[model samples]
Structures are given as C-alpha cells and as structure tokens.
Target: MVQLWKLVLLCGLLAGTSASLLDIRGNDVLRRLISGLERGLDTFDSTIEIIFQNLKTELESRCSDEVVEQQETENFLEQLISRIFQVVSRLTGVRIRNVQVPDITFEATSENSANVSIPITADVTVSLPFLGEIVDLDLNVDLQTTVSIETDTDDPQVVVGECTNNPESISLTVLHSRFGLLNDVVDIGVNLARRVVSSVVEGELCPRFRELLESLDAECVEKLIGESQDTTQQEPEGRR
Candidate 1:
C-alpha cells in the first residue's frame, strides 16, 4: 500500500539522463521525452481509478456487515479509511483532464549535467470523498530539472542517465475552479504533495528514463552500423 502511494506520486513528478550535452537539433528529443511523461501520467490516472473502485467496494462490504458479528472488522475499516483520507487529502486534484506541455528546451551544462525547462498546463478535478465534495482545480506549472548523463565505456556514443527534479522550487499556479477557489485549503498540503512527488521522480521515474535513453542509444547504434555496412557493400571492387 505504501509503495502504491509512491507510484501515485511518481505519476505526478517525472525524470531522465544523458552525456556531455549533445546539441539537441530537432523536436524529436522533446517529443520523445514528453511522450513518455504523458504515458506515465495517463497510466497513473487509470490505475488510480481502478484502485478507487476497489477500495470503495471494500468499504461498502465492510459497512454492510452485521454490527455485533464483525465489530473487529468495522474497527479495522474505520482505521483504514482514516489513513486513506489522510493520503488523499494531500493531493491537489483527483482527476486530470487535459494536459498541455509546451515545447521543452534543454541545455547541457557539463558532461554530467543537463537542464530542461518546460511549462505544463492541466485541467483537473479535486474530489474530497471524505468531505463528500468535488471541485475543479486547474493548474499551470513550470518544470526545471537537471539530469546526469554518463557515457557507456563500451560505446561512448551511448549515454546512460537519470534526472532529479527540484520539486521544492517548482513554480505552481492554481486557478479558481467553477465551483470555487480552494488554493488556501490545498496550499496546506502543497509541500506534502511536492515531497511525495520528488521521492517518486528520484526513485522510479529516473531509472525508467535511464532505460529509455539506453534503448534509444542502442537503436541509434544499430542504425549507424546498418548504414555503414550498406555504404561499404555499394562500393565497386575497381575502386579497391
């Protein structure tokens, strides 16, 4: 259950890595990075919905029990719900609608350091089941983070890496929902949310990003080798 919470938070904050910053030429790199982030978040939302349904079912079952027959079960359910609420309370939103990630700009600072900046806008609904109310919470957030890129010894052209985001310094703007403004209330848990998100980014997301970089690097190497072979094969024996 604790691990699940970490995953939930990771779905919110993202990560990555690379080599001495290569001059990023086209939108391809940014496109690929955002694609992974979007996919991770989409999966997160679906997984949460599934979990919510499962938990709701369990709660209903516990509540349906005969009072005297399952006193212990009732007690356990109460404690579980309380803990669950505490976890949910720290999140700013419960459901995400549209996510718009603007073009990302990346610059390599050194062989081991690279920085990326992007603006993300999203529409989300905040549901407080414990309070029996749901509210809209739109957001505009600025993301700035650094990644560590290491060159593979066997293949120096291939870079392996990981990223750590400065969540504590992330700029976030919460807009009023149609229902009302809840920033004051949500602000109370903003730091908590940031901390949880940071943990996931550093732990799970970073490793996954590293894997992605490695995979891309492998594909590039294969393509180059194939092209070289084709070029050699095309040469005439007379030239030799």
Candidate 2:
C-alpha cells in the first residue's frame, strides 16, 4: 500500500511540473507578440507623420509660388500701361504729362474641366498738356477698360471700342475757341480716344498713327477749313 501511495504522489508531481512549464511558455509567447505589435504601431505612426509633413511643405510651396506670380503679373501690367500711354501720345501728337493706373483686377473662373475664363479690368488715366494757345484747360481723362482672356486658345482676341459690360462708351468731348476762328475740337478728342483704344487692342506701341488717324473724319474738317481760308484770302486780296 505504501509503495502504491508513493507512486501516485510522484505521478501527480510530474503532472504539475508539466502544466507550470506550459504556462510559462505561453506567457513568454504572449509577451513577445505584444512587443512586436507595439513596434509595428510605432512604425505606422512615424510613416504617417512623415507623409503629413511632406504634404504641408508641398502646399506651402504652391501657395508661395502663386503669390510671387501674382505680384509679377501686376508689375508687368503697370509697365504695359506706361508703354500704352507713350504710344498714344505719339499717335495723337500730344505730350502726355502722366499716365496712372488706378486699379487692376484679375478674375478667373473655371468653365469646365479644360477651360477657364479670366477677365482683367484696368482703370487708366492719361493727362495731356495744353497745346497751341489752349490755356486754362488741362486735358486729363479717365478710361475704364475690361479685357477678357480665353484660356482654351493660344492667342487671346481683344475687342476695342466695344465695352463688353456696358453698351455706352466712355468718351470725352472737347470744344476749343481760338483767335476768333471758331474752330471745333471734336475731331481731336475723338482721335485721342481712338488712339487709346487702338493701343489697347494692338498690345504694343506702333510708330505710325496712320491707323487711328485714317479712321477719323479729319479730311472733311480740313477741306472745309481750306475752302474757308481760300475764300477769306481771295476777298482780302481783291479789296487791297
């Protein structure tokens, strides 16, 4: 009986030892798996942070580039206005005292996936000095022009003498009285307006003013003046 009891106790001890070993092995495996999962989570967090930083940098760069480009465009437009004034003055045979660009606006709208429409509004002022005994009269005119740019085409079409927004054109009329001659300055004012409009359309300065001059009715005025002068000269000569 004693031997049988001892044998049973030995068997029980062996079974307990095997169960404890299995428990220790299972705990070690669980700890290793938890550590590996933590490491994986940290790596994922680092990757996400890197991606976010890169995205932020890219956005900043794009925004900065846009700002610089806008400033450059504004400068170029100011220069263009100055050049236009130079051309108009030469064409009109007048000395432009100053050229001012009061306002410049650029608006862009997306029409579709492929096309965008950009409208530019420029408010310009041209000052012309008094010429040929025209005293106490300063010729300063304000012109508001709006130009459209179609992004789909390579060459943009410019329409002059027609305001896209307003049917009525902005114009200045001048009347001059000199030396009892009673000459009208209607053609001069019209010529100046036409010259400015043409400059805007051509987008550059041209040496000759023939295009704008030919469009005016200056020849009719000259013919009437010439006939009057000839009649006056003949009458005075016959009397003498």
Candidate 3:
C-alpha cells in the first residue's frame, strides 16, 4: 500500500525539477503538486478497492462449505462472527472521499535543516460486501505528521517524526455505519481501527513517505543545483 502511493510524492517533483530554484514560486508549485497528488490519490483509491475485492473473493472461495448450525445457536454465531471479522479485516474495502492534504508547510530551522508538516483530512469507508454490504462504516481522519529535512548532503533525507494519536495530532470519528445487526460490532471495531490506523501511519506509511520524498527531493534538488550552477557560470565575475 505504501509503495503504491509513494508515486504521489514524485508528481510534485516532476514539475519542480524543470525550473530553477529562484524561478520557482511556492504558490504555483504547491498548486500543481497538490493537484498532482490528488489525482494520484484518486488512482490509489480505485486500485485499492479493486485489490480488496479480488482478495475477498479469492479467500472466501477457498473456505470449506461444511454445514454448521449458524442461525441462532450462541456458540455457532460467535464462531461465525469471529470468522467474518477475520475475513473483513484481512480483505477490507477502503474508500477515501474528500481527501484534503494541506499545502506542504516547511520552515528552515537551521542552515541545513528544515521542519515540515503535512496535515490530511478525509472520509474513509471500510466495508465488506456480503449479500450487499454487511460490514460498512464511514470514518473521518484528521491526521498530521512532522518530518525533518537534512540538507547537508547533495541528497536531502527525510526523517519522519511521530504522528501523535491525540485529538490535536490525529483524530478519527465514526461518521456512520450501515444499519444492521453488526452495528455494535462496527462501533467496537471503530475504536480499534483508530489505533490500528495510527500505528499504520507511524510504522508503515510514514517510512514509505520518507523513502519516496527523500528520493524525489534529492533528484529535484540535484536538478535545481545544476540549474543554479549553470546560472552562476553565465553571470559576470563582478556580479559574484
């Protein structure tokens, strides 16, 4: 999942690399970057949905169809729900709507270090299609992460900081759930899902972003440096 979405960061650099640093306007670069990332995210959303659908179908097909009393029997029902949850968590449909990633904000904290923050908002739906949609719920994610840029070398490195789960740093809420017998279970899952998401951001997604951002940032910076050197050579010695 992380590797797939990392391409979104590359889109920003594609445009930035074509121009010199002095010629780059933050507003224009940011606008294009945001638009590019948004399109990448749309693709990300669709691709993941299809992947989940395929996984669910393939896995469920492998299960044995042994007859079990699954109706009102307490033991049977409990076992069934447990199996269902296992299936849902493993192959779940995730749809993200109203994805809002604020302009990448950064400030140079030192000669070769910068602080960067990214805040994202979105409506996410987690579901499993069973006779229609059995496990379904919409969640709101307000997430932010801080990173540092070490620019001492030709290659800029992105050091990811913690994405705190507090209300201020990151927050998730249950927007709604499909009305059904599983609503209570959905509620409990929401609480667990919130923590799971936070962990994913910290352990999985952030590292991927760091890798992608550093690779692209270095490439773009190298291009800009070359451009700057060319510009310097063109200048008269008195101007230096």
Candidate 4:
C-alpha cells in the first residue's frame, strides 16, 4: 500500500513539472523581446546622433561663409530683409548672418519617446542706413522638442508606426540691442527666424525618425522570435 502511494506522488510531481515548462518558455520569450527592444533603441539613438552630426557639418560648410560675408554687404539690413522676403517667396536661400548651426542631442524618455534639445548662437548684422558699419546683433536660441513613438495600427508586423513632435519651448535673445533705435526691429526678425528654423527642424525630424524606427522594428522582432523558436526546438532535442 505504501509503494502504491509513493507511485502516485511521483506522477503528480512529474505532471506539475511538465505543466510549468510552458510558463518558463513564455517568460524566456518575453525576456528576449524586451532585450531586443532595448538593443533596437540603442542603435536608433546612435544612428540619429550620426545623422545630426553630419547635418551640422554640412550646414557649417554651406552657410558659414555666406553668413559671415553678409556683415560686409552694403546696406546689409535693407538687403538682408529683402533677401529674406524674396527667398520666402520662392521658399529657398533664407540665410542668417554669422550663422552657427546647432548640434542636436536626443535622450530616450521611454520605449517610444525621446527629448531633443538644440542650442544655437550667432550674430545678425543690422546695417543702419545712416551708419556705414553694422551693429553686431547677437542671437541666442534654445529649442526643446518632444517626440512620440507609436506602432502602426493597421500593420501589426510593422512595429514603428508614427512619430509626432510636440511643440516645445523656444527662447530667443538679442544681446546688447538696448542702445539702438532698431532694437525692436532686430528682435522681431531674430524671433521670427527662430520660429521658422524650429518648425523646419521639427517637421523634418519626425518623419525621418518614424522611418528609421520602422526599419529597425521588423528585423529586431524577427531575430528575437527566430532565436526563441530555435531555443524551444533545441530544448526537446536535449531531453530526447
């Protein structure tokens, strides 16, 4: 009778062990998914950094000379404003004087969001009609924007769906413009330029970020899922 009881207990233990294997496998798969996501985000962040750095380099090369030369332009204030308006008409060649291209930095806020901060400093030369030499109008700009990440509702396999940027804080400053009669004019122009640049950057980044994230998602998921399946298949083979 005691041997019969022992046999029953052994079977119960074996059944309990078998039942828990599925739960263990599921937990492992979850771990792998999380790990894959973390790696994907890291790669995304690095790629964005490289892209921004390249942009900064390109802007410095392309616009720096044109801007610095604007200080030497005759009747710079009149010509610059006219140039700005003309460019706005065609939507091209809108340049700022003494231009310093901003360096962009991104920090991940969550699995699907990030914060971007860009700081900029430059000089806008305003040539008084009566004064031959220009006023070295300093510009300081601080731009902060938040990006949201979401999965595409229509495509479950397409992990990265949309990137939306929240309108953020923009601070513009013109240093030492207190003595001039054109102080208000310069301030207004500087603030306007800040807004234009901020909008352009936000618009460009959101779509690009969405595309990059989407590209990463499918491959990341595939690799992780494939590894999990391989591990599961090997487990039964090991037992055999």
Q: What TM-score do all the candidates reach, one by one?
A: 0.38, 0.30, 0.38, 0.33
* lDDT for each residue of candidate 1 in 63-157, tens digit (9 for 90 to 100): 24356443433233223222322333333233444555444334455534445444555554443323323334454545455444345566445
lDDT (Cα, tens digit) per residue for candidate 2, span 1-240 = 579989868766754553454334334433443343434322423443343344334323432324553332233333344554444444433334344444322221221111111123332332223324321223333333322323355643322122222213333334332322212232333343444443333332211111221222323223323444455556766574
How many residue pairs collide in each prediction? 1, 0, 0, 0
Q: Cα lDDT for residue 136, model 1?
A: 46
Tell me, what's the RMSD of every candidate? 23.1, 40.2, 25.5, 30.7
Off by over 4 Å in 4: 1-102, 128-134, 148-170, 176-240
TM-score ranking, best first: 3, 1, 4, 2
Stretches of candidate 3 above 4 Å error? 1-90, 128-169, 180-183, 216-240
Runs off by more than 4 Å, candidate 1 = 1-93, 108-119, 130-154, 177-184, 189-204, 218-240
List the lowest-lDDT window of 10 residues for candidate 2: 109-118
Over all chains combined, what TM-score does candidate 2 have? 0.30
lDDT tens per residue, model 4, 1-240: 579989868766644443354234334433443343434322423443454444434423332324543333132222222332232212322234554433444444544454545454555433222232223445554445554444576544534434433334444445544325443344434444454444443444344434433444433434433444454556766574
Q: What would you estimate as the lDDT of candidate 4?
A: 0.41
Determine which window of 10 residues in candidate 1 has minimal summed lDDT.
Answer: 16-25
